[model samples]
Target: MPNLDLWTFALNCYAREGVETACLELQSQGADVCVLICAAWLEARGVARNQERMCVLEEVAAPWRHIVVEPLRELRQAWRSPAEQDEALRELRKTLKTLELQAERSLLERLQTASREWDESADANQWLSALAPKGSCRVALETLRNAAYQTQLELAGV
Candidate 1:
């Protein structure tokens, strides 16, 4: 596997067809998109899944998602209607969207830093299943998984 960093890997996979919608569905089901992207990166890199490591990544991500990302996202979404009617509000909403993205990028960086030392093996693709929220939409998860697999192949020059 190529040694792409988490943020780059995430951007690649999330840009794939159907991945954004699948991720949004997963997010609506209470899954953290950042953590899910981290899981995809780990899977692509063949990093083995374990409770301890999952916990560690979640620990690194959850607080920031709650305190930083979500609030920005919520505010951005909340302003959508009003912003459509006001130029200044639209500009501020765009800035909020940028901040939300930056927050998510920071979370991905934290995840990558936390998992930097994990050993990789051939059977490490179980991360998506392990990290996905319970009762998540199977179709959405499958879409994400397939995109991640395609991303892995592309990175490997397959």
Candidate 2:
């Protein structure tokens, strides 16, 4: 559970080039960005993915994701054009986007706390596939996994 703060993992990963775009693409396909961040952390820490852990994640994150995080994300995305047109709206939109990211970080914290009992074993694809499913968000999952791997490698200085 050491170094498993979901927020830290996510911020580090999301800061990587192309990760934000990839995450947004996955979100468009109904993939839970919180779950994706959890998956990346699990993968990075060598956590095993299974039904029990999945259920834990879902229970912890589903409500917040559906009710809070997703709405903030949608609102942030919805502001993209309006923010561009109005100079004043730009700063407000930026603050909102920051809030959206913080909301996601809270969701990730919940996930990390709930998943503390699970075993750790690495395999990036399982969590992505489990969260997304075949043919639904496959491309996004693949894209995320590749990006996660590169980010992990880079962070490790390998």
lDDT of 1 by residue, 1-158 (tens): 66778787888899999999999999999999999988887886788898999999999998998899999999999999999999999999999999999999999999999999997886675788888999999898889888888888887788
**In model 2, how large is the Cα lDDT of residue 78?**
89
Regions of model 2 farther than 4 Å from truth: 121-125, 150-158
| lDDT per residue (tens digit) for residues 18-61 in model 2 | 77888888777777888887887777666778787788888888
In model 2, state the lDDT of residue 81: 93
Cα lDDT listed for each candidate: 0.89, 0.75
On lDDT, the leading prediction is: 1
> What TM-score fits each model?
0.95, 0.81
- Candidate 2 whole-model C-alpha lDDT, 0 to 1: 0.75
TM-score of 1: 0.95
TM-score computed on alpha carbons, candidate 2: 0.81
Candidate 1 residue 141 Cα shift, in angstroms, is 0.8
Q: Which candidate is the best by TM-score?
A: 1
